[model samples]
Target: MTSNPPIPMRPIRTAQSRFPWHHFSMRFSSTPRGARLARRLAGERLDAWGVPYGSDTHDTVTLIVAELSANAVSHGLVPGRDFRLRLSAEGTTLRVEVTDTRGEKVPALVEPSDNLDGGGEGGRGLLLVAALADRWGWYPCADGPGKTVWAVCSASVLAAPSP
Candidate 1:
Protein backbone atom coordinates (compact mmCIF):
# COMPACT_ATOMS: atom_id res chain seq x y z
CA MET A 1 0.00 0.00 0.00
CA THR A 2 1.35 3.46 -0.92
CA SER A 3 1.35 6.05 1.87
CA ASN A 4 0.06 9.46 0.91
CA PRO A 5 2.06 12.59 2.01
CA PRO A 6 0.58 14.29 5.09
CA ILE A 7 -1.11 17.69 4.54
CA PRO A 8 0.35 20.74 6.22
CA MET A 9 -1.69 22.26 9.04
CA ARG A 10 -3.01 25.77 8.75
CA PRO A 11 -2.36 28.41 11.41
CA ILE A 12 -5.24 29.19 13.72
CA ARG A 13 -6.88 32.59 13.33
CA THR A 14 -7.51 34.91 16.28
CA ALA A 15 -10.56 37.10 16.90
CA GLN A 16 -8.73 40.06 15.41
CA SER A 17 -8.21 38.14 12.19
CA ARG A 18 -11.95 37.53 11.86
CA PHE A 19 -12.89 41.21 12.19
CA PRO A 20 -9.74 42.87 10.78
CA TRP A 21 -10.66 46.50 11.51
CA HIS A 22 -13.41 48.98 12.39
CA HIS A 23 -14.04 52.39 10.82
CA PHE A 24 -16.23 55.45 11.40
CA SER A 25 -16.49 58.64 9.37
CA MET A 26 -18.77 61.64 9.64
CA ARG A 27 -18.96 65.26 8.47
CA PHE A 28 -19.90 67.99 10.89
CA SER A 29 -20.52 71.68 10.54
CA SER A 30 -17.55 73.85 11.39
CA THR A 31 -19.00 74.87 14.72
CA PRO A 32 -18.37 74.30 18.42
CA ARG A 33 -21.57 72.32 18.71
CA GLY A 34 -20.40 70.09 15.90
CA ALA A 35 -17.10 69.46 17.63
CA ARG A 36 -18.95 68.51 20.80
CA LEU A 37 -21.10 66.08 18.84
CA ALA A 38 -18.05 64.48 17.26
CA ARG A 39 -16.43 63.87 20.62
CA ARG A 40 -19.58 62.29 22.05
CA LEU A 41 -20.07 60.06 19.02
CA ALA A 42 -16.44 58.96 19.08
CA GLY A 43 -16.71 57.80 22.68
CA GLU A 44 -19.89 55.90 21.88
CA ARG A 45 -18.25 54.19 18.95
CA LEU A 46 -15.20 53.19 20.98
CA ASP A 47 -17.41 51.67 23.62
CA ALA A 48 -19.13 49.61 20.94
CA TRP A 49 -15.74 48.37 19.73
CA GLY A 50 -14.91 46.73 23.10
CA VAL A 51 -13.08 49.69 24.56
CA PRO A 52 -15.31 50.36 27.55
CA TYR A 53 -16.73 53.89 27.94
CA GLY A 54 -14.55 54.77 30.93
CA SER A 55 -11.47 52.87 29.80
CA ASP A 56 -8.22 54.66 29.21
CA THR A 57 -8.36 53.85 25.52
CA HIS A 58 -11.82 55.32 25.16
CA ASP A 59 -11.07 58.49 27.12
CA THR A 60 -7.80 59.09 25.32
CA VAL A 61 -9.33 58.69 21.89
CA THR A 62 -12.30 60.88 22.76
CA LEU A 63 -10.08 63.63 24.13
CA ILE A 64 -7.96 63.49 20.99
CA VAL A 65 -11.10 63.80 18.94
CA ALA A 66 -12.22 66.79 20.99
CA GLU A 67 -8.96 68.65 20.53
CA LEU A 68 -8.62 67.91 16.84
CA SER A 69 -12.23 68.72 16.16
CA ALA A 70 -11.98 71.97 18.08
CA ASN A 71 -8.90 72.95 16.11
CA ALA A 72 -10.64 72.22 12.86
CA VAL A 73 -13.58 74.37 13.86
CA SER A 74 -11.52 77.19 15.33
CA HIS A 75 -8.65 77.49 12.85
CA GLY A 76 -9.47 75.41 9.79
CA LEU A 77 -12.96 76.72 9.29
CA VAL A 78 -13.98 78.02 5.89
CA PRO A 79 -17.37 79.62 5.33
CA GLY A 80 -19.99 77.15 4.07
CA ARG A 81 -17.68 74.17 4.57
CA ASP A 82 -17.74 71.36 7.09
CA PHE A 83 -15.15 69.35 8.95
CA ARG A 84 -14.84 65.58 8.80
CA LEU A 85 -13.97 63.14 11.57
CA ARG A 86 -12.65 59.67 10.89
CA LEU A 87 -11.79 56.89 13.33
CA SER A 88 -10.27 53.52 12.56
CA ALA A 89 -9.04 50.61 14.64
CA GLU A 90 -6.71 47.99 13.26
CA GLY A 91 -4.36 45.54 14.84
CA THR A 92 -3.48 47.12 18.20
CA THR A 93 -3.83 50.76 17.16
CA LEU A 94 -6.65 53.28 17.09
CA ARG A 95 -6.30 56.26 14.75
CA VAL A 96 -8.23 59.54 14.90
CA GLU A 97 -8.27 61.90 11.94
CA VAL A 98 -9.97 65.29 11.51
CA THR A 99 -10.15 67.07 8.18
CA ASP A 100 -11.15 70.61 7.38
CA THR A 101 -11.37 72.78 4.26
CA ARG A 102 -8.65 75.26 5.15
CA GLY A 103 -5.45 73.46 4.30
CA GLU A 104 -3.33 76.57 4.70
CA LYS A 105 -3.97 76.83 8.43
CA VAL A 106 -1.76 73.99 9.57
CA PRO A 107 -1.56 73.26 13.30
CA ALA A 108 1.62 73.85 15.29
CA LEU A 109 2.75 72.61 18.68
CA VAL A 110 3.33 75.79 20.64
CA GLU A 111 5.53 75.46 23.69
CA PRO A 112 3.54 75.48 26.90
CA SER A 113 5.94 77.97 28.43
CA ASP A 114 5.35 80.42 25.58
CA ASN A 115 1.60 80.32 26.04
CA LEU A 116 1.81 80.62 29.80
CA ASP A 117 4.23 83.57 29.63
CA GLY A 118 1.89 85.31 27.19
CA GLY A 119 -1.11 84.62 29.48
CA GLY A 120 -2.84 82.89 26.61
CA GLU A 121 -5.90 80.80 27.28
CA GLY A 122 -5.57 78.76 24.10
CA GLY A 123 -2.98 77.21 21.71
CA ARG A 124 -2.58 74.03 23.72
CA GLY A 125 -4.60 71.57 21.62
CA LEU A 126 -1.73 69.90 19.80
CA LEU A 127 0.25 69.77 23.01
CA LEU A 128 -2.41 67.63 24.66
CA VAL A 129 -2.63 65.42 21.55
CA ALA A 130 1.13 64.86 21.57
CA ALA A 131 1.03 63.90 25.21
CA LEU A 132 -1.82 61.41 24.88
CA ALA A 133 -1.28 59.92 21.44
CA ASP A 134 1.61 57.65 20.61
CA ARG A 135 2.01 59.53 17.31
CA TRP A 136 0.32 62.53 15.75
CA GLY A 137 0.74 64.55 12.55
CA TRP A 138 -0.97 66.14 9.57
CA TYR A 139 -1.22 65.69 5.82
CA PRO A 140 -2.94 67.50 2.98
CA CYS A 141 -6.09 65.79 1.85
CA ALA A 142 -5.57 64.02 -1.46
CA ASP A 143 -9.03 64.52 -2.92
CA GLY A 144 -9.80 68.00 -1.68
CA PRO A 145 -8.50 71.41 -0.66
CA GLY A 146 -7.99 70.56 3.00
CA LYS A 147 -5.68 69.04 5.59
CA THR A 148 -6.13 66.05 7.83
CA VAL A 149 -4.73 66.05 11.37
CA TRP A 150 -4.21 62.53 12.65
CA ALA A 151 -3.31 60.88 15.98
CA VAL A 152 -2.70 57.27 16.86
CA CYS A 153 -3.03 55.38 20.17
CA SER A 154 -1.15 52.10 20.41
CA ALA A 155 -1.89 48.89 22.33
CA SER A 156 0.21 50.03 25.28
CA VAL A 157 -2.70 52.31 26.15
CA LEU A 158 -5.47 50.50 24.30
CA ALA A 159 -4.80 47.19 26.05
CA ALA A 160 -5.77 48.54 29.45
CA PRO A 161 -8.24 46.25 31.18
CA SER A 162 -11.82 47.49 31.49
CA PRO A 163 -12.76 48.69 34.99
Candidate 2:
Protein backbone atom coordinates (compact mmCIF):
# COMPACT_ATOMS: atom_id res chain seq x y z
CA MET A 1 0.00 0.00 0.00
CA THR A 2 1.32 3.41 -0.98
CA SER A 3 0.46 6.40 1.17
CA ASN A 4 0.75 9.94 -0.14
CA PRO A 5 1.17 13.05 2.00
CA PRO A 6 -1.93 15.22 2.34
CA ILE A 7 -2.20 18.04 -0.13
CA PRO A 8 -1.43 21.50 1.17
CA MET A 9 -4.60 23.48 1.76
CA ARG A 10 -4.50 27.11 0.77
CA PRO A 11 -7.43 29.44 0.42
CA ILE A 12 -8.48 30.58 -3.01
CA ARG A 13 -9.20 34.27 -3.46
CA THR A 14 -12.20 35.20 -5.56
CA ALA A 15 -13.61 38.50 -6.74
CA GLN A 16 -16.69 37.81 -4.64
CA SER A 17 -14.44 37.67 -1.59
CA ARG A 18 -13.10 41.11 -2.40
CA PHE A 19 -16.46 42.76 -3.20
CA PRO A 20 -19.70 41.38 -1.94
CA TRP A 21 -22.52 43.39 -3.47
CA HIS A 22 -25.31 44.46 -1.13
CA HIS A 23 -27.30 47.11 -2.92
CA PHE A 24 -29.01 50.34 -1.83
CA SER A 25 -30.32 52.39 -4.73
CA MET A 26 -32.16 55.70 -4.66
CA ARG A 27 -32.77 58.48 -7.13
CA PHE A 28 -32.22 62.12 -6.34
CA SER A 29 -32.90 65.28 -8.31
CA SER A 30 -30.05 66.55 -10.42
CA THR A 31 -29.40 69.61 -8.31
CA PRO A 32 -27.09 71.01 -5.67
CA ARG A 33 -29.66 70.08 -3.06
CA GLY A 34 -29.50 66.50 -4.31
CA ALA A 35 -25.76 66.51 -3.97
CA ARG A 36 -26.02 67.69 -0.40
CA LEU A 37 -28.63 65.05 0.34
CA ALA A 38 -26.39 62.36 -1.13
CA ARG A 39 -23.61 63.14 1.33
CA ARG A 40 -26.00 63.48 4.26
CA LEU A 41 -27.89 60.27 3.54
CA ALA A 42 -24.65 58.37 3.10
CA GLY A 43 -23.94 58.94 6.77
CA GLU A 44 -27.40 57.74 7.70
CA ARG A 45 -27.13 54.68 5.49
CA LEU A 46 -23.75 53.76 6.92
CA ASP A 47 -25.17 53.93 10.40
CA ALA A 48 -27.93 51.52 9.46
CA TRP A 49 -25.32 49.22 7.98
CA GLY A 50 -23.52 49.01 11.34
CA VAL A 51 -20.72 51.36 10.28
CA PRO A 52 -21.93 54.19 12.52
CA TYR A 53 -21.57 57.94 11.97
CA GLY A 54 -18.09 59.51 12.48
CA SER A 55 -16.35 56.15 12.16
CA ASP A 56 -13.30 56.21 9.94
CA THR A 57 -14.93 54.08 7.23
CA HIS A 58 -18.11 56.11 7.39
CA ASP A 59 -16.24 59.38 6.99
CA THR A 60 -14.09 58.11 4.12
CA VAL A 61 -17.02 56.70 2.21
CA THR A 62 -19.07 59.82 2.84
CA LEU A 63 -16.41 62.11 1.42
CA ILE A 64 -15.91 60.01 -1.65
CA VAL A 65 -19.66 59.86 -2.12
CA ALA A 66 -19.99 63.63 -1.84
CA GLU A 67 -17.38 64.24 -4.49
CA LEU A 68 -18.85 61.77 -6.91
CA SER A 69 -22.39 62.98 -6.40
CA ALA A 70 -21.29 66.57 -6.75
CA ASN A 71 -19.67 65.76 -10.05
CA ALA A 72 -22.87 64.08 -11.13
CA VAL A 73 -24.90 67.17 -10.42
CA SER A 74 -22.39 69.57 -11.94
CA HIS A 75 -21.25 67.74 -15.04
CA GLY A 76 -23.74 64.98 -15.67
CA LEU A 77 -27.09 66.54 -14.94
CA VAL A 78 -29.75 65.96 -17.60
CA PRO A 79 -33.09 67.75 -17.59
CA GLY A 80 -35.84 65.69 -15.99
CA ARG A 81 -33.42 62.91 -15.14
CA ASP A 82 -32.36 62.19 -11.57
CA PHE A 83 -29.08 60.68 -10.39
CA ARG A 84 -28.71 57.45 -8.45
CA LEU A 85 -26.37 56.37 -5.64
CA ARG A 86 -25.57 52.96 -4.25
CA LEU A 87 -23.40 51.76 -1.38
CA SER A 88 -22.50 48.21 -0.46
CA ALA A 89 -20.04 46.23 1.61
CA GLU A 90 -18.29 43.17 0.35
CA GLY A 91 -16.47 41.62 3.27
CA THR A 92 -14.01 44.26 4.43
CA THR A 93 -14.48 46.38 1.33
CA LEU A 94 -16.89 49.30 1.18
CA ARG A 95 -18.08 50.25 -2.30
CA VAL A 96 -19.62 53.54 -3.39
CA GLU A 97 -21.19 53.87 -6.83
CA VAL A 98 -22.93 56.97 -8.16
CA THR A 99 -24.76 57.03 -11.46
CA ASP A 100 -25.68 60.05 -13.52
CA THR A 101 -27.32 60.59 -16.89
CA ARG A 102 -24.41 61.69 -19.00
CA GLY A 103 -22.83 58.76 -20.72
CA GLU A 104 -21.05 60.85 -23.36
CA LYS A 105 -19.22 62.80 -20.70
CA VAL A 106 -17.20 60.21 -18.86
CA PRO A 107 -14.97 61.00 -15.89
CA ALA A 108 -11.19 60.69 -15.89
CA LEU A 109 -8.22 61.37 -13.68
CA VAL A 110 -7.47 65.05 -14.27
CA GLU A 111 -4.29 66.83 -13.33
CA PRO A 112 -4.65 70.21 -11.69
CA SER A 113 -2.88 72.83 -13.79
CA ASP A 114 -3.43 75.66 -11.33
CA ASN A 115 -4.47 76.43 -7.74
CA LEU A 116 -7.22 78.79 -8.89
CA ASP A 117 -10.55 77.10 -9.18
CA GLY A 118 -11.07 79.43 -6.18
CA GLY A 119 -9.32 80.61 -3.03
CA GLY A 120 -8.60 77.69 -0.69
CA GLU A 121 -9.89 75.33 -3.40
CA GLY A 122 -9.06 73.56 -6.67
CA GLY A 123 -8.46 69.93 -7.69
CA ARG A 124 -9.26 68.58 -4.25
CA GLY A 125 -12.33 66.44 -4.79
CA LEU A 126 -10.86 63.66 -6.86
CA LEU A 127 -7.59 64.18 -5.06
CA LEU A 128 -9.24 63.17 -1.81
CA VAL A 129 -10.97 60.23 -3.50
CA ALA A 130 -7.69 58.97 -4.90
CA ALA A 131 -5.96 59.23 -1.56
CA LEU A 132 -8.66 57.53 0.50
CA ALA A 133 -9.61 54.66 -1.79
CA ASP A 134 -7.60 51.45 -1.92
CA ARG A 135 -8.88 50.83 -5.46
CA TRP A 136 -11.28 53.19 -7.26
CA GLY A 137 -12.75 53.26 -10.76
CA TRP A 138 -15.88 53.73 -12.89
CA TYR A 139 -17.74 52.20 -15.83
CA PRO A 140 -20.67 52.88 -18.14
CA CYS A 141 -23.93 52.04 -16.49
CA ALA A 142 -25.18 48.72 -17.82
CA ASP A 143 -28.68 50.14 -17.99
CA GLY A 144 -27.53 52.57 -20.69
CA PRO A 145 -28.76 55.75 -19.04
CA GLY A 146 -25.43 57.00 -17.69
CA LYS A 147 -22.05 56.20 -16.16
CA THR A 148 -21.20 54.89 -12.74
CA VAL A 149 -18.40 56.34 -10.60
CA TRP A 150 -17.19 53.83 -8.03
CA ALA A 151 -14.63 53.54 -5.23
CA VAL A 152 -13.70 50.81 -2.79
CA CYS A 153 -12.73 51.47 0.79
CA SER A 154 -10.93 49.21 3.24
CA ALA A 155 -13.38 49.13 6.11
CA SER A 156 -11.94 50.70 9.25
CA VAL A 157 -14.64 49.25 11.45
CA LEU A 158 -14.19 45.65 10.31
CA ALA A 159 -11.21 44.59 8.29
CA ALA A 160 -11.43 41.49 6.16
CA PRO A 161 -9.53 38.55 7.61
CA SER A 162 -6.41 37.23 5.91
CA PRO A 163 -7.01 34.27 3.66
Per-model TM-score versus the true fold: 0.83, 0.76
- lDDT string, candidate 1, 22-85, tens digits: 8989999999999999999899777767776776777889999999999999999999999999
lDDT of 1 at 159: 53
After superposition of all CA atoms, the RMSD between model 1 and the true structure is 11.7
Q: Model 2 clash tally?
A: 1
Q: What is the lDDT of residue 79 in candidate 2?
A: 93
lDDT accuracy of residue 62 in candidate 2: 89
Q: Clashing residue pairs in candidate 1, if any?
A: none
Best by TM-score: 1
Query: Relative to the unseen true structure, what is the C-alpha lDDT of residue 22 in candidate 1, on a scale of 0 to 100?
Result: 81
The per-prediction tally of clashing pairs is 0, 1
Expressed as tens digits, the lDDT of each residue in 1-163 for candidate 2 is 9995642333424534643444567889999999999899888766655565766767888899999999899889999999999988666678888999899987777776576755635456777788888877878888787898888887443333434
- Show where candidate 2 strays beyond 4 Å: 1-22, 113-122, 155-163
